[model samples]
Target: MTIPLKLHVGGMDCAACATKIENAMKRLPGVTDISVSYGQELLSVTLDEDRTSRAVIEGKIRALGYTPAGSDVARTPANDAQAATAPWWRSPRGRLVIGTAALLAVAYIVSHIEPSWATWAYVAATAIGLVPIGRRAIVAALSGTPFSIEMLMSVAALGAVAIGQAPEAALVIFLFSVGELLEGLASGRARAGIRALMDLVPRTARRLRGSEVETVPVEALQIGDVVLVRPGDRVPSDGDVIDGTSGVDEAPVTGESVAVLKEPGSTVYAGSIGIDGELQVKISRTTADNTIARIIHAVEEAQATKAPVARFIETFSQWYTPAAMAISLLVIVGPPLLFGADWFTWIYRGLAVLLIACPCALVISTPAAVASGLANGARRGLLMKGGAALETLSKVKTVAFDKTGTLTRGKPQITDIVCLAGDENDMLAMAAAVERGSSHPLGLAIVAEAERRGLDIPRAFGGSSVTPGKAVTARLKAGFVSVGSPRHAAGKSALTPDQADRVAALEQAGKTVVVVLQGAQALGMIALRDEPRPDARAGLEKLRSLGVRSVMLTGDNARTATSIGSLLGLDVRAELLPDAKLAAIAAYRAKGPIAMIGDGINDAPALAAASVGIAMGGGTDVALETADVALMKERIEGVAALISLSRATMSNIWQNIALALGLKAIFLVTTLVGSTPLWMAILADTGATVLVTANALRLLRYGNRRSD
Candidate 1:
């Protein structure tokens, strides 16, 4: 006897808004269940054939301040016109009509005017309001759909009219409309946060070709094309700097407040604003693959994916609506027929039961809880892409982390330089001269060290050539110089026994020792290794306490990985390739839910394939785009906080759902047995909504909770 109904609902803008609509629909007597998605602007409801008509469902939505499009009420064109012409509540003068009816009811209730005249006036005002608002409900009930919430309200109003109690009818309709309007307004505001993120990407870009800058659509900019960005302009594409240098304000991308200096060879992201310089950048990614574009895609996907509990509500609403309507009809009509009460009065009461039985409350309970949870997460530095990710995070039993940038400070510096046969000054001078022409991070560190020591590097060394994972060889006035890894220099037998021993000692300490030699003899060994981030140990301990097992995965060799793992007290150490890391995550996922934290291009695949992937804010575009959650502040403590927050948010959502449904069940039982009045129905519907909303808001304190 249950019929499925899909409605396109307007005025929903966030998860919270979707919750409000779902709740409002569930509260209706005939509605069995409901699902509302703010991202899709869609609402699906199930209703009982014997108890509710489509008109009642539509009317309930209208009362809550939403226009239901494509429902059986057949107001599609009118709804579309209303959407185009004015706000849902303001259009068709529904609010004004309800207001006039309300004023007349209030005057009659308080005045000493002639009772007969007051009754007639109230009836006339009710008729005026019902003609526009309740007409659909009346028609739907007559059309074999019977017992909709709207029909119930209409029948009650007409009964009041028939019995000469016009003021009551007007009051009921006016109050219903007020509730609808409040729900609509609340839903609209909740969706605004996600919409704001979408607004950051510009639709166009300016391409600089042969000194001519021409504006083109963002999608048309191909890789290798040069794009010109002016000061105060947002980068329309992700690219490498080809010309010019400037400070870029990357707050939108990294969530940091400071502007980062950008010189030649620096990388820039889409949607980041240029603060002080013009830039000519060679596009590295297509518009579809750009940072902002991927962010939008991820957020959209997240919003569309329902949480597990949300899916249950969707399935529940599919049947709950129609079943509730039939039960309400049986409750109202069967008892009276057996007892031989007046048929009309019994039918009227049955209709009241139907109106009160609408499933508005049940439909919204879960979604509102989700919206509030997501918003609260965003407010704290954790950006949960969707309900699914939020749900996954809560259930994660194992957390895997990438070592280099995630656990240790990504930028390692030269901590020590050991001289072998030569004096310290000579060894450093030659090494710095060779490294000065190289661009590797280690080379940069050596150059910095030499500069710090006030050693002048001769300019006579021609440009250097670098071999990946090997060494940088340069032509210097003294001779051909090489500064590189120990393996590369060792192949040439450049180190003496004493110098090799010294380098071995440095390497054993988990430092990357670079040996500098001019062909035959060892010069000196310079060690570089990322220091552990200050919060690394504390964060790891927190995760352990939370019962989430922690593992460290790194591309670094076993020695380095083992050293870091031991220092941080990780339960497992995985020194792996990108594929090995991904396999490890998949294997872990087989046992239960797992979360992976990484921040490199190599980590992108694993990050995407994990149950939950968290990326550092300053990580590569691929990693950031692939991650489900982003830690805006690159700190290990934030990772622990994110996990804790996710668990807390999920708990809050479940609690809200339980409370909302529990209240509804109690109300339904009481109403069915005649222990509750029509006024009680109104209070339960509205009051439960308020309570669910308040409960969901508790997620706002997720991160700040010390024990959590």
Candidate 2:
């Protein structure tokens, strides 16, 4: 069997580190695939276990001069605190800080006491400060990527020292180290946000064991265990309330600010905080399969998939570094050989060109913003799959929504009652009694309405049968009662003009008109309707504000669909079956990228067919699996928020790209003129990287405009 291995690789300071690891691992005979994520500090490899062992993989990683931590090595409080207080020399950042400080101290002392030895003092500082950077450069070169940023920095710093610019060279390495430290910290922070999601789950859970409460590790929690939750504590796992009642705050999982009331049978998720009451929850999911776990897993998986722009940038970077190297070689050899320029001066200029062409900032421009965007969306109850969906969402010109459960609450309610002959109350009571044993949605609506009106609903004399989306029938006291579609109610007899007119009026107003019949005689009619969500209009208006057109696709009849569409000012494609909905999505594609938002069950096909599939959180697991994005809040406004975040993220990515490329262009030109100093070139390169990273992190603050 091909087993997957996940390793937490240390000392990966940049994207080039990931590339180098991938290149080295691909040479192994049994390794079929290798993916290293600098943002996550994770290396995922697929290999035949029989052919290659974990020991072999770890050895290879060690040989490449990187520490390999196993997946089981979790970041606990003790370990985290220890890491925080570790010695400065132990970490790459600390080493750089110490090395730079020592070099500066040596330079100060030598310049004051033995001024003639100042050059040697700076040279010694360069050698010490450049160790970490030089090691990575050599590893990358040996791994077949000769034009990594480390390589460029190493060459530029060494060339400076060779030209008798030891002080400049030391300063360049110092600044470069500082930049690498900043990038590492930024990348760590981004991954930490994702890791913090796991932290939200309590490590210990109070399990109910034979009337006594025992504290146990969350990992030991099993399905069907009844866990006791007290006030102010996070629910330990995904479960249902078996006893007691309380208000559970599910913001960590659903992003809903308000705490939902949980009573017996109400579902609760892991990471929800209990407030004001105690409840015993029967675990439905194990600790590793909780909602929070799925979300964290989804977000990490999403980040692994590259966005279109990120892929383009990755491809561009491959050629970009080699092109920069070629340009640098030309600057060194071309100027002197072709124009009789001074060799030493031209060489210095060429090294400056190399420093300016590191491409660290450019290579990271898209993924950084993309990673932040995914995290931002995840925190806000929006689950966008990856950069591809995030980027696609921004370009979607049209959004198609499933009407039921998406635009409306999906719960049908009794709206009207018309009596042609029998008493209105009597007829409704009969209808409710006939549907009492039926599990159909409309039947449930009728039964609920009867109970609300205090009607006496008698038991059916025999078993009731239901035809989906049509009718329900049962044996009653008088004879037989069949509550169903208007056609079914008519049953070989035409409806009176008055009855027909009443049904037409009700249907025209978007109500589902059902006929109550006894044998061949039509008794009366009852109308039910699923009301539009309170925020539906406002959410659609937000879409319009963003210049995205909205359309409603529903399986409802034309009259009902039109009424709802007109009410919300949306373009309507009514009476669409699941296949028809998919077909509509196909037709919309001709106009532009179309986003299909649905309840994620009945709409799964359509969701998959659209450019971007958005699922409501309450949707089935299959629907969630098929969707590219999910709004856990089940709000139409989530569409607007998703688009807003995508646009902001794409905008942020472009800004970083422009900033990196713009600064590099200016410095490259200045370096060729011999006016740009080595420190300035190094500073520009490092500064651009820090600037772009800071800009990308701003996306973590994205907010929702409306509630679901």
Candidate 3:
């Protein structure tokens, strides 16, 4: 049987370090799949349990000088807290740097008095730093990864010592260690954003049981239990309110700027804060499955799924490292042997080139930007599945939207009622009795209006059936009654010129007129219209400004589609079935990549067919699990905001790559000309790695303001 293992890894300061661990672990006997992400500090592996156990796999990782935090079988929150809260000076890496730096300081002070004593003093400092680095390099080589950044630093420092440049060797090790410290600090900022989300849920909740209210751990609360939230308290978990109306601030979870007025039956997420009224919220989700927890998990897991540019960089670095080493070997041998040039001078240059080829910044450039982009998007409620989705979304040229619930307010109320025959109440009761069982949006709208008027609808019909996209008819005691579209009414019943003209006027006015017929004689017409959302027009305008075309596809008539389309400045594609929508997605693909946004089950096929599928709802289960992108909050403007975010993330990644390679290229030229010293090469490499990391962090502030 195959079993999977997930462990939090430590000591991975660069993307090249992750590659070294992955290469060493894949050679284990039964390891089938392995992924190590330095940005996430995660090691995920799958293997056959019969051939290899968790201990054997973890031993391989340990042999590569990477620490694997205990597996799920023995892991605890305290273990993580201990590792995270521990001071930097207490760790082995920190002590080595401090000791090496202290020795280098003592040697510099002593060199002014006696140069002979300072020579060995610098050797002692270099030896102290080189011992641990050399041991790790040997262990990495034995584990099948001989070309790691550690191996490069170890060889470069040792070569500098051989040429009697002990001072330069000591300073090189100190600077390399300092660079690793800077990387750890920068990566922590990205992880801290995710930790802030996890901290939003209160550890304990106030659960209400009958007349008594008990305060217990959040994990102790189960589904169906009600909890009381007082003023200025964050919600314990995801649930629906049973009583009390409050102004809830959801900016932390959903990024809605203003406070939302949440009443009874309104859905509340786990991290939102409650103000004013005390709300009794019934728990609907478990502690581990809450909204904030899922977002954190998704963002961490997304780091392991590399984007195309990241994968390309990783592949390029594989050959780039060894090729640089080969060139360094040639430089040391060709100059001294052929021309009898000074051996010490050429060998020093060779070591400088090797240190310049560390590949730390080049390897980490893409993943750091991608991880920051994913974390930034989650903070604003745009949950992208992986880097692939984020990259693909940046290339979307057209956005296809579903009509109902997507571009408009999903709820449709009865706007106008016309009575052609009997009392409006009696006709409404007949229509409500026929439509109470059906789940169509129009039918539900009619039934809701009848119930609001306090009409008693009796179950006086049987053998009810729907005519596909047309009306619904049923067999009653007196005769058959139907409440369907005007087209369905025109086919079965004849209407006089005046009544027909009234229906035409309503249809032209963008009202979905459902004719109520009693035994083939028209009783009246009830006009229903699903109004456009308040932000719908502005969202399309934003998309237009970004050079993305907007179009709406619906099963409604062309007149209605055009009315709503004109209001929102969108092209209308109406009367499309589920299969027709799928075809429409394919047809749009001919022009350019498209993203299909929808909230209903029928939109799934079209979503899958598009370049990127964006599920739009109030974070319902169907929406969360439907597509590559899930919009938890129903903001039509969010679609444009996400597109802007994707473009910004890609731009950040390009800037990182240029900084990494551009610095390396400049130092490579100087090292070849003998103008740069050995220690300066290492300093340039360290500076480039730190600069790359800091640039990628800029994406975390994206979408926070309109100007951004």
lDDT of each: 0.69, 0.83, 0.84
TM-score of 3: 0.87
**RMSD to true structure for each model, in Å:** 8.1, 3.6, 4.5
lDDT tens digits by residue: candidate 2, 592-687: 999998877778788889999999864235434668999877778889989988999999999999999999999988887778999899867789
Query: In candidate 2, which residue pairs clash?
Result: none
Per-residue C-alpha lDDT of model 1 across residues 1-708, encoded as one tens digit per residue? 888887877655344345546666665677876777675477777888678877877776665445666654422223433454456556434475457656666557644566546766777777776764576564444443343445556665676577655666666666655555555545544444444444455667889878788999877999999988899888887899978999998777655557888878999987789988999889999876776556554554565678888788756754665776677678667877788766655554554555555555555666665665665555444566788888888888988888877888877788788877667877787788877756677878888888989987865355787787888878778787788888887788887676678788877778889988777667778898787888899988888888889988787888777767787888555557777877888999999988888873557787887898887765355444557887755667766677777677667766766776677678777765657655455555556666565565555444454544
Q: Candidate 3, residues 305-338: lDDT per residue as tens digits?
A: 8888888998999889899899988888888899
> Predictions ranked by TM-score, top down?
2, 3, 1
Put the candidates in lDDT order, highest first.
3, 2, 1
Q: Determine which window of 10 residues in candidate 3 has minimal summed lDDT.
A: 72-81
Q: Kindly report the root-mean-square deviation of model 1 from the true structure over all alpha carbons.
A: 8.1
Q: What is the TM-score of each candidate against the true structure?
A: 0.73, 0.90, 0.87
Q: Using TM-score as the measure, name the better of candidate 1 and candidate 2.
A: 2
lDDT of 2 at 466: 78
Better of 1 and 3 by TM-score: 3
